[model samples]
Target: MKHDRPKISDVARLAGVSTATVSRALSAPERVSEETRAAVQQAVEATGYRLNLAARNLRHRRTGGIVALVPNLANPFFSQILSGIASVLGPAGYNLLIADTRTADAQTLLDYAEPSRADGLIILDGTLPATALQGRVPVVEACEWVPGLPAPRVKIDNRAAAGLAIGHLADLGHRRIGHVAGPRGNVLTEARLSGTAEALAARGLPFPEEHLYPGDFSLDSGREAARIWLDQPAATRPTALFLASDAMACGFIGEVQRHGLRVPGDLSVVGFDDIELVAHISPPLTTIRQPRTEIGRAAAERMLACLKGETREADTVLPVELILRASTGPAPA
Candidate 1:
């Protein structure tokens, strides 16, 4: 004959704690003392107790999971953000489901917004139309967002952050600075481009429209911008550059070297997004740190609130900081 399964009451009895205390230990251990938690854990191991997640989910009428919809899974920038999100949600016993928009077909992509798939959603793609997310599940926008989207947003002040990047370049005495722009239609690209323009004007620096090169915020785009600079006369080409993303800045730097140009000695460059790769690259990149971990944690919190029928604020904009590194220096004499 099969042995009977251990129950919650058995665990509580073994631990010498009330059933409520046992539940609390499993659900919110932080609310209990360390000694109490240890006893409950010991009781669980002794009784061979395991949580019945299916039964709990059935009773609560909820899936114990949330989905994060990222535009690109390959981009390392999203990795830290996802880690931060997991750190917050995991402690609460919620599973994280990663949905990569790039891999999904148009038909399957919209399924992410469906409430039936997960309890909530954290959308990191700004280009998706607001109408696409009209499902019943609560939604939070992180890193990027589309205007008029009703969901809560947790991100940095992109325009101001971009302005900070450019201001740093200006302070270095580089009046004739070039910019590697992001994709044309992206909200980030628009905000950063406008901010760069404003910063240049405020500094009373030169910004020839021709110097505003088109880029897709990719390594190839960065290399192309560098090639265009190479085509220009050495005396007229800008002494400094402010790339839209660290990936692009790194590409530009590598290509410039391949073409026999010295960074800082020949060209000073500043990049946006202080990604990990930026720090390890030769002559580390000076960039605006977006606090990816903070943004991710905040987004998870906001989503949790929304799921609880709370009315969260429209947007929470975190501050950005400029990280000075070996990539930037005083303008060439």
Candidate 2:
């Protein structure tokens, strides 16, 4: 037996709405009321009606795809952000294409921005030059952003977030604070480093050059930082350290424990990007919680706006929270 598939008219009839309303409800949900959307959904479920997305995209001259450029696809911090992006774009009938720019050159990365490839782009790599993305497809920068690119960026205030970390430590009676900074030439690294300095200055605290350690936001760099801290004379060591990333903080804590050390008892540690792993560590990490998923969602919304020819001149800055955990405590007596 052969049965013809249900059409949009069938769905409209079942929902007691016009075919035009059904089309708008399915394709651009925001254009319709909540009750209408619910009715359309029920009608769709009852009639087993499916949209012909391929044909619709062909008629509209759209590729039905959105590309996201991530610096490191393996990093857990980015997982939630990517999930958020997918949550929105998927239901909107757009395919998400994630490209890792970790080892890609400028020219190679630029190729992904062509309009023929995808309808829009979501860039999370801040290291790319402004020239690479200037006149290409519509873009929304998430988490990280190029300095001079004329695109809407969705991120937290890195400087203020760093200040929160420093303020927390200072309130806990820790006078001499140390910082594990990210690599040079990175925008986040620069912002956070400057924030650390500004916070210290505001409190009239001394940040000796030796208290600053170089890192590349990796577990290995954290381990190396632990070694450097351990080598310093006991009397001159800072009472607490604020690491640039949670992975690095975890690595430093693990390495320090291996060499017979107690967190918060002998030394306290704070980290950024409250990733999931931090909560389960030996001494749960105290860190700055970035709204990673929200950042992604906001970025996707901005991309959609750009596609609709809407202009957003201001950047979106989300709020961050300082989560207190066992990894941080008052300065040792």
What is the per-residue lDDT of model 2 for residues 233-331, given as tens digits with 9 covering 90 to 100? Answer: 978888899999998999999999999999989899999999999999989999999999899889988888898999989999999999999999999
Evaluate all candidate structures by whole-model CA lDDT and list the values in order.
0.87, 0.92
Q: Give the Cα error of residue 71 in candidate 1, in Å.
A: 1.0
TM-score of 2: 0.94
Best by lDDT: 2
Positional deviation of residue 253's Cα in model 2 after best superposition, in angstroms: 0.6
Best by TM-score: 2
Over 79-137, each residue of candidate 1 has an lDDT whose tens digit, in order, gives: 98999999999877789999887777766656766655778889898877777775568
Q: Predict model 2's lDDT versus the native.
A: 0.92
